[model samples]
Target: MRRIAVPWGVLALWVAVLALAGPFAGKLGDVQHNRAVDYLPASADSTQVAKIQDRLPGGETTELVLVYHREGGLSSADRAAAAEQVADIDRKLSLVRTPEGVPSRSGDTVMYPVASTGPGQDEKARDAFVNDVRDLAHDTGAGLSVDVGGPGALATDASEVYQSLDGPLLYTTVAVVALLLILIYRSPFLWLVPLAVAGVADFLSMGVAYGLNQAFGTTISGQSQGVMTILVFGAGTDYALLIVARYREELRRFERPYDAMRAALRGCGPAVLASSATVAAGLLCLLAADLNSSRGMGPLGAVGVLCALVAMLTLLPAVLVLLGRRVFWPLVPAFGSRPKERRSLFTAMGSSAGRRPLTVLGVGAVLLGALALGAFALPGSLKQEDSFTDRPDSVVAMRTLAAAYPEASSQPITVIAPTGKATEAVATARDTDGVTDVTRGRSGSGWTEINVVAKAAPQTAAETATIEALRDGLDGRGAYVGGPSAEQLDLKDTNARDRLVVVPIVLAAVLLILVVLLRSLVAPLLLLAAVVAVWGAALGIGGLVFGPLFGFEGTDPGLGLLSFVFLVALGVDYGIFLMHRMREEVLGGAPTGAAALTALRTTGAVIASAGLVLAATFAVLTSMPLVQLVELGFVIAVGVLLDTFLVRTYLVTSASYALGRKVWWPGPLSRRLPGAPAAPPAEEPALTRTP
Candidate 1:
């Protein structure tokens, strides 16, 4: 165990250097790509490509569209008043330019477009502008209604929500964890220990995440940032609690603190390592996702769990070694005291389960299978618009636009044709299947801009096929389709490629970790298989629940990635806890059935408790504004509960008992160590009770 420190130190140093170097190295690839795409020309064949390309707005600009209405046609007075207020607000805002185009007024309504010219523009300026306009609208209360929408307004709202919620979420999580620890341990210092370990682990994990982003050019999204904080705090504290709980139990038997720590580590180390590996593997499965945002979360989460493991095994032990018995303080006398002889509920449950393993296992399997019936109902559509908060101004604006001009919600597809071929291209696009409208711009710079409107939403497969057909209609004669629809097609293609490359790599990594921890070829395979089944069940159930029950049209792309990673990682945690305890019982010379029963009796309650806490914490994500978060939270919470209770407690126990001692066969680790005394016979009471 001491030898593990050398590699750990080196990894920590590497992560530190990476974290420091990452931000400056253009590590935020997505941000950079966004800038580049904004600056680049639409394609050589665009009719006004040259003029518009050079005049394109900078990437930082925030487009603001204000919609206002009055009872009578916007009287000259109303229009003039609104225009003056907008101009005044624009003048006061840094980096803001009057929208290049003029305000357009129609009967009883007016529209104003505003743009920010630079990245350093203060968001407060937008807030102030909205506030002023809102006040003006209120002054004309009877006749006027005002609503602001655009990238700027949406950005402001999102930023405010995040800023407001982040601190409260952190404090709430910490408070909850602290209270839970204090209640469980009944020792102030001991309760604080997990928090201390978690804090260190979080620092190190974030540093490593920053480093990975630098080295790999990964982009961490807002969602990942939120999840990372929660995972680090929650999982880190959970791991520490597991270790400390065992340490306290050991202290009741050992005379010296050092002995207690060492014994606790030896007994608990394998379990901790296994649990971490499973979690890391599960999260790493996200690497298989098509979305880079989803893929990035995998390694980011894995790094966090790994850091927590290192801190628990090293930093935590070092602290305990220094603190000695004083770590328990006023609780010292309780350490050596005996527990009551009453039968615990957990033990009774285990006894019932053991007596009718088939019935318990059968019922669990049936329930999961029933939920999984919804799998076929899952929709694969990934529309970005559905991801927003239900009441967001952007969504409201979109709905309004959709109502005003039903087809306005549809995106125009850009079909670029070689110079001098504008007329022919427009004709060809209009003739193509599924094409509803084809408008050709006046020839400019010898090139053409052909806009093709689709009958269906551009992101749908029908529209994608239409685009492909139009591109094919143009042949190889230098026509490129590039628009929102085309970009979505490209995104889909990229995601498909990513999914193929990532899933296998993540699975391999998970398998390797399992094999290394279990040191048994058979057990790793079975555990991985069980995890896969649980993952399938989770996704299937999530699909059904979200699709039919909740009326979500399609699964959030991020949800699938999140589900895959969480199911694998969290499922592994339960597997490790159960399997490790089973191994311990076997080592105590208990027969297969008794060993399985004892393992369940001892570890089942803790695993169930941990799973419930994690599930509840994750379930809180449903309260977030975004639909994606809600779906993700629900899926992960359900998956964790499934893994902890059904898979870990029943499925795993059944498999292990069925395997018996053969589960440990073909491994030197399973055999009695040479020159070491044999373990006591199975008939002897294994544990030495403190009482």
Candidate 2:
């Protein structure tokens, strides 16, 4: 396969354009429109409803509660200082004027609305506000606690967490990539090339993500940002490593550097392309999800993977062609040495398992089945308050609210009935099961606001049931319930829609890619089956660890869905790597058992090493402070390990051995095409080798 310079240039240009356009891209528009609509009161007439919405607080403004304690409740001095600090912060924040004006009030307890001015305009204002508040509380001799229970606070806390993780994540990713390259190549210059490619890939991916956000009006949350960074680094490095490793091996067979590069591309390009396609397709499946975050993540992540692949195939090779043998300087080579035949541990395992494919397959099936026992038992609730670290101001405030006014801690449900009908609706709703109180508010043209207070947390089962009951009771009466609890109900409904839509889409995409690459319907089906099993097992394990083992009462309802997406995408890596080796062995004319052995010995080491790196990179998320990060980190890490060790090693080997030559049946794609040599090609002469 020849390298195309034009495509490479075009890709570079496209990346440049995205970079230039980055700042102009507007923030991700809200994808949760239904959630907002669900919160409107049912009693208001259409016109009044619109007017009320117009006067309501902007979506960005959130009511924040700052809490502090002194020995004898709140001392006068402490109250005075805290009040002043709140006022100053409010004044400074006033510069960030949103569509809905900031409401300010002062007394023993200060209350105000904080507006988000995007990432632009006084970037340091929020930080400064937080610091100033903390300092004042300290100076006043009060045990300070700031509870930010508003949307703005959530955004602020998320940003802080990402910023905190960014530095360490970057450093760790780079260090890990460099270490891997150094071990693989032993040449400093050669090792640096792939890192450089990965860096470029990162910049290009981020630029594209920014542009996509602009074009599609999708919001890129803090979680997405952090995951994108780690993914770009890890995936880019892995792709580059595979290409470079193949290049070195090919160079051992050819006299010319260009020939070696071509040879490597011919052997590795198809595999890399296939692998990239599977992952990208898997990510693209997120488009089917109802959540804006999930849907946006799919395309953004796919773009990142595509950029990495382009760099690996084009830029890296072009640089290698230019550098020639000098790329591996300080190394000298001797000609005519016998080609080394590495031991195949995977092949041995494959052969042994091949003789017992059913047993191996059955074992894997049982393990996954057992793990999946926890699937139905998994809890599904959104604990936004606990999403952040307990130490965060928002979390603290939420906790305090839960203690002081449990009823008010959750979002208020606004039940709307026609102005004249609100009294009857309010009276009926107030008496409804699960409702703690129902307060009637200003009524307009045939509409009234009936505030329905729930007896449980907004995200709890009881609240959801209550919301449903209220909606059912007021059906066709222009009744609309809007508030935080209603929003949760909408989110839950949306998530359910996503699960139904995304899983099949991803599965089909992955299967299609595998079929095209492997040229065997049977193999793709089996591989997909393995991936599904691994995904289920991962979720089950996560449920056990987080749900029961760790005693985490809160639920990350989206965890299972997210795990499915990630495992299907990433788990394919091991399968592709191993299967490619098996094909190569077959092309070399090894008998079924011998070929499997050869594949295991030669490719097994690389897969194991790569899996280790990938798993470790994912495992780093455990150190992050947020619950989502920790859960995501553990699930992906464990899933990758299972894919690498159990599914790829034992299960695949067993199947391949059991099928023997039949594994490649029904397609000439497995056979070398016209003009391609059948026997193992002669080893290329080494251009250079380091002692």
Candidate 3:
């Protein structure tokens, strides 16, 4: 009666919590922002420029370029039509000035540069203006085509892709997890339990995330929210797997469902808690990053992992206990019924690895090292046009402009100077090397805005040099030089600096967590070393594939750092699970060799399943239109797979086997008991237990 009442009480409590969580969760999407300014560090020159622009009259301008092109030379009619459209746009939209058409040297292409400040800082208004322009700038259909582009249009397109990510990414991730669970459990009702709980966890995380944003003004982005959802599902499902596996095993030994659950929690709760703590701790290290996106992701990711942990440990267990052994359906484990004994796949692999630990260790290390060499082949920082996997109108426009205006920049390098020093700043900017032209516009709020054009195109090294020169020349002159090109330059430099700071913090945090959990210095080091190797190898694989196979023009600036944080943190989870079980076996009187093999034999399948689920969740990001998400997803997913199969199964296991008791060095287990034999006793028959 008490057991039944407890389960009912928990269900009622969850219902109340969900009722509260439901509203806030729906509001999370409302607070999400994907603007380029949102991702930049507040201290960056580009961010300061954006902020100041918002304060000036008419607000930040939305710049656009209307590309009018024909395969052959543009006829007089085409030019006239282009002019008429530009005139209509100027009349209909609130333009900074009437746009003038610039014809290409080939006489086949013409571009009309447009700018409007009517939208101010309102994203909806800005998007509406872009859409209105796109509608008004219709193609001639007879040969002449039009593409509305530039930084503003590119931002709109990126926002749309980000907006689309929420629905499809969630559904795809859910479907993938459901399918995998169906296959892994082979039970009709079993998969639904964990999936439902994960959904609830996701709902809860969203609510918490929204509250954090509102209360603390934490920056929220599409990437961070999407990743939060993934963590809620991926990490949530992993905790579920470990819990359910232990619960299933306990059900066979205990008479009542409540007792069985209690035993199961005692068995696996430490590992699950430690796993979530490690992930949360490691993700929290991202707070040290100077990049706004990375910094925001830290809290959001930690929130996700912590929420998943709570749900899996509490709601999942209560629901499962209430359902009792019958939840497993046809394959339900009856009380006192032993699982089938057979030589499983993990048994064979473990035996082989244990037989030649050094050989297996050396070979696996070499394979990972060889893969790491491919990192050298990775492309440079991704340019704006190449950021999208699908070529939208904005990308097309940029490409067309690049081909047509081979030597000139269509984008402006914006410099904001003190109103008092505007004259001096203008003269200095005009005199700066690579400066093709300079125009002074908009003066208010103690600042004057200046637009400078470069001889080189946007994001090119020459343009980068010009931006640097502007910053250097303007140093202490109370002027800020920034624009799309300057923003990219700042982003690249900031990401590089962030890697140096965040990597060491993440490593120390994760290593400390591992040491505390394993109670052995050597064991934690081995696990950390294995996961780091996996990160490098996974990135190497991306290098080999991203450019040649995927046709990606460049890598995302944040890829290496983000991937390392995820891989090292998430990758170490499997190690903890395996090592935890090995420790358990050793404490249960099994010798070191027997324990390593035994842990692998018992837990490998579930670890592999968890790995598959996590990898697949991230793999869904590959299906996204954004190249950054795709690159990040591909690297992390590959790293998880490598960690699960190769590093955890082969290297860590073999290293432990070879090290014997020394794997537990600095712990009591490092020394043999008084009566223990030098050599371990024969191994016991392996059980084919799986969850």
Name the best candidate (by lDDT): 3
Ranking by TM-score: 3, 2, 1
User: Which 10 residues in a row give candidate 3 its minimum summed lDDT?
Assistant: 679-688
User: Candidate 1 lDDT, tens digit per residue, 65-102?
Assistant: 56656654667677777776666666666434454322
RMSD of each: 6.7, 6.8, 2.5
- Positional deviation of residue 110's Cα in model 1 after best superposition, in angstroms: 7.0
Please list the C-alpha lDDT of all candidates, in the order they appear. 0.62, 0.64, 0.90
TM-score of 2: 0.79
Any idea what lDDT model 3 has?
0.90
lDDT of 1: 0.62
Return the lDDT, model 2, position 377.
Answer: 64
Q: Look at candidate 1 and tell me the lDDT of residue 233.
A: 71
TM-scores for the candidates? 0.76, 0.79, 0.97
Local accuracy of candidate 3 as per-residue lDDT tens digits, 117-196: 89887777888999999999999768899999899999899888898899999999999999999999999999999999
Comparing 1 and 3 on lDDT, the stronger one: 3
TM-score of 1: 0.76
Off by over 4 Å in 3: 677-691
lDDT by residue (365-481, candidate 2, tens digit) is: 898889977666665564766665456766765555555444443445667677766777887797778888777754544456565768776567777788788877877776777
